[model samples]
Target: MIEIRNLKKSFGSNLVWEDVSFSIEQGETVAIIGRSGCGKSVLVKHLNALMYPDSGEVIIDGRNVFDLEYISLRKMRQRFGVLFQGSALFDSLNTFENIAFPLRYFTELNEEEISDKVMEALELVNLAGTSEKSPAELSGGMRRRVALARATILQPDFLIYDEPTSGLDPKTSEEINQLIISMAKNLNITSIVVTHDIHSVLKIATKVAFLEDQGLHWYGTVEELRDSDNEELMSFVSASEYQIRN
Candidate 1:
């Protein structure tokens, strides 16, 4: 499990968050939601020690994140799998190479072993035959799935997805949402998903946390969100202007 305690962060004079704390148990999918510029992105970065806070502590599976040495930090990061905002695929690499990138860097696996792993990840995302395609050749939804393939190819112990279904058709969004949940179970990994999509929340959130006012507004089960009386979360769930185009 990951536990964040009394976290605080700032940029010069602007304080982003203070006293932020929450926990994500193993095998649970925690969905975080907040308005734009509410520091949601900043908080997720702290999960893998990508960014450090000015004070407080993040403990991942019993190790203090900030205390880890350089090599330890690198090893710590290997346990994390991140899917970025827009898949962030390299334009020059084909899908197979993209998925194989981390394996080639982190392990001594030969070409055949790497190919086997890449193919498994691609199969999990149902993109088994698109290995030769470049980022420019795939649709936005497919690119996201390819990125997911790349992220999970490492088989991280914990996964963080930042807006996994940001831009896609309704059907594709549903497919992506369901796959996110299925992956957690199939991989037996802890998932921390940050998104504004209520549909995705309702569909896959085992636990939900409302982030606002520089701290955790509320943290509870998905049923609690649906039947919530919290005003902050109500506003997020009721937000109606985030238009999704076809």
Candidate 2:
């Protein structure tokens, strides 16, 4: 389980958010949603210690990640996999090598073992035959799948997706959403997704966390979100739908 306690952050005199608290149970898919620049990405960055809060505790399995030493922190980070917003794949590497990079760097696995793992990951993302293809050869959605394959190759306990469907058309967005759901169920991985897409949130999230007004404005299950009468949340949802339709 991951527990976030009294999280606070600021840059110079600009306060991002404070008094944020929430717990993510194992196997839960939590969507962190808010308007652009509301600090959703910053909040998820705290989970893996990529970013730190001015004051707060991010406890994973009873250990405060903020207090860990360098070696310990590095080990903790290896348990996470991140699918960046831009599908940060290495253009120089083929699909196979891209996914195998982590295993080569982190583990003592031989070439055969690495190949097998990479193949499994590609198959998981339905990209089994494109191992020799470069990132540039893949379409936007396919590149995202390759990125996802690389992210999960190490079988991380937690998966963080930053705007997983940002530039995709509706069909591709739905495909990515379904892939997120599949990864969660198949790997039993805890997921934290930072996105502005409300429709994707409804399709993939088990729980929702809304960051607004410099705080975690509301949080609850997806069902609760749909039934919520909270004015700000309703407005945000309506606005998102309007944008989607236009």
Candidate 3:
């Protein structure tokens, strides 16, 4: 289980959020939603210790990640796999090499083992034949899938998706959503998704965390979110859906 305790952060004099707290049970897919610049990405970054809070504790399996030494922190971070917003694939590397990069760098796996692992990851993403293709040759959605393959190749305990559905058409977005669900269920991984796509949230999230007004404004199950009576949250949801429609 992951527990976030009264987290706080600031940039110079600009306070981003304060007193934010929540817990993510194992195998849960939690979606963090908020308007742009509301610090949703910032909050998820704290989970892997990519960003430190001004005050608070991010405890994973009873250990405070913030207090870990460098080696310990690196090991902790390896337990996480991140699908960056832009996919962040290296254009210089082909798909096979991109997916194999982590295994080569982090593990002692030989070339044959690396090839077998990369092939498995490609099959998982349903892109088994595109291993030789460069990122530049793949469409936006395919690029995202390749990125997802790379992210999950190590079978990390946690997966962080930063705007997974951004810049995709509706059909592609739905595919990505299903992939997210499949990853969580098949790997029993804890997932944290930062997105503004309310429809995508509804389709994939088991729980919702809403950030606003400099704090975690609300949090609950997907059912609770749909039935929520909070005026601000409802307004935000409605507005987001409207944007999707028009």
Predicted structure with the largest lDDT when compared to the true one: 3
Give, for candidate 1, the lowest lDDT window spanning 10 residues: 237-246
Error of 3 at 106 (Å): 0.8
**Which candidate model has the greater lDDT, 2 or 3?**
3
Ranking by TM-score: 3, 2, 1
Candidate 2, residue 246: how far the Cα is off, in Å: 1.2
**TM-score (all chains, Cα) for each model:** 0.96, 0.98, 0.99
| Global lDDT of each candidate | 0.88, 0.94, 0.95
Residues 141-213 of candidate 2 have per-residue lDDT tens digits of: 9999999998898899999999999999999999999999999998999999988899999999999999999
The pairs that clash in candidate 3 are none
Which candidate, 1 or 3, would have the higher TM-score against the true structure?
Answer: 3
Give the per-residue lDDT digits (tens) of candidate 1, residues 1-246: 999999999999989889998888989999988888888888899988999999988898689898899999999999999998888999999999999999999999999999999998899999989999999999999999999888888889999999998878779999999899899988898998989788888888899888788778899999887788988778777773244321
Off by over 4 Å in 2: none
Candidate 2 lDDT score at position 3: 99
